[model samples]
Target: MNPKVRNLSTEVLSDNWYILRKVTFEWQKKNGEWQKQSREAYDRGNGATILLYNNTSKTVILTRQFRIPTYVNGNESGMLIEACAGLLDKDNPEDCIKRETEEETGYHINQVHKVFEAYMSPGSVTEILYFFVAEYTKDQKVTEGGGVTDEEDIDVLELDFSKAMKMAQNGEIKDGKTIMLLQYAQINQLIKYN
Candidate 1:
């Protein structure tokens, strides 16, 4: 059983919010054979995503933004409803998510429980997403969100559990990480269905 990486080649595919690269790797398989596999790897940018829940209000904080990819692909408006998420420049997942949550929804989440980590699009992109769930309250302070001028345009949204579930069922929520986190929260009873 021999496993070794031989060579790697990368080519730029796009340069939007995040740079996309098609990566090809040559490797030696365990059976002592050489193979090549290509994957679209997103540059490892510092990014974090989190779901904010207010159990008392039975509501969750989300964001709506226009996604170019979704728009160009098939979505009517290309608008994506998702949890608060952003790239981490100098912070860990927890810190990054907290900051993003605050910046996107004015909710300061102090305690965050890690759900899981996943690759948003492994086959074609290399974006590793860290997912988390945090508890907030109706009394939690709220303010206008959306970051600096360069990255402004985010609209904050709050939805009750039932509404969010309905959106998920109706296929309105298309972001993979958000879907996964919401489903996870539902299955774990962290969030009520109604």
Candidate 2:
């Protein structure tokens, strides 16, 4: 509720997968005139993502999966390499990311350092993504994680931190969330590399 906003309403356009809504509202311009506008927004709920790093080994864990949206948007292979992430269906950010990390990467991390939260796509998507990083050791692996659902076919990858950064620089790692986490690791010196 802002002083500049009035006459707001929302209409559900679709609810097949998650939800798509049409929002109509009126805004008071700086010149003191009211303007009406309508926009479509997709609400898939908030999500959390985590990057598993080994400081001593200078390595990081990532995941690969086929994304239909990227495929239709001219991604030739449709396979995307990204940090372990999932929608927070019924859990808080920390708990949800821990569950997702173990489910997708097979590493049962106990403590995660929350770096930041951001809206990945604010234009039309109503999802705020929580980002985190955690240290991982060989003993943390509990299972051969490839997701618990039949619909999720994920491949876990353990890559050198430097090589992963190179992948991001060369456009091989195009996912925004993954790239952001990688950069964060580099900037924060999560692992010292020469």
Candidate 3:
């Protein structure tokens, strides 16, 4: 909170799984005038995401699942291809990403590298997402991970790294987090193959 900004009032709109609130505030402009405003924020908590890659095979693992919000917003089937990600309920970013990777993609990757963090939708959502990448081998897989339970119904995809990047370029992979991770791989030269 800055001294120039005064939080006048706040009203909670919902608090089921997360929280949504409307905040009214007054801002002291540099010109010394007071300006008032109100805005709504949806806080679903922070989250973590990881991209799993196989350097030997030059492939990457991803998941496709039905997203209700996307479906309502013009996506036909609503199935989005995305990197393994989850909300950090009570764990640190690294631990949360590890658990999400295993549960969503069936790969128990142990050694992971953090790339960076970003606010995906900072305008209205108060979620800071941690981005990570991990190298995986065939021996690391422990389960047929289509998600933990039947409700998740995840569809795992192991595609060529080049092809994945192309999909990101050609409008196939629409998820922002997944695109950012894939681009990070390309930009950082993090993945190498035969």
Winner by lDDT:
2
lDDT of 3 by residue, 1-194 (tens): 68988867989999987899998999999999999999899999899999998888989999999999999999999999999999999999999998888899889988899999999998899999999999999999998888876689999999999999999999889999999999999888878653
lDDT of each: 0.82, 0.97, 0.92
- The model with the greater lDDT, 1 or 2, is 2
Q: Comparing candidate 1 with candidate 3, which one achieves the higher lDDT? A: 3
The TM-score between candidate 2 and the true structure equals 0.98
lDDT of 1 by residue, 14-58 (tens): 788678888888888778898999877667585788888877778
> Considering lDDT, which of the candidate structures 2 and 3 is the better prediction for this target?
2
Considering TM-score, where higher is better, how would the candidates rank from best to worst?
Answer: 2, 3, 1
What is candidate 3's CA lDDT for residue 146? 82
Model 2 alpha-carbon miss at residue 153, Å: 0.4
After superposition, the stretches of candidate 3 with alpha carbons farther than 4 Å from their true spots are none
**Tens-digit lDDT string for candidate 2 (1-194):** 69898889999999999999999999999999999999999999999999999999999999999999999999999999999999999999999999999999999999999999999999999999999999999999999999999999999999999999999999999999999999999999999866
Worst 10 residues of 1 by lDDT: 139-148
Candidate 1, which segments miss by more than 4 Å at Cα?
A: 10-18, 29-31, 37-39, 192-194
Question: In terms of TM-score, which candidate is stronger, 1 or 2?
Answer: 2
**Cα lDDT of model 3 overall?**
0.92
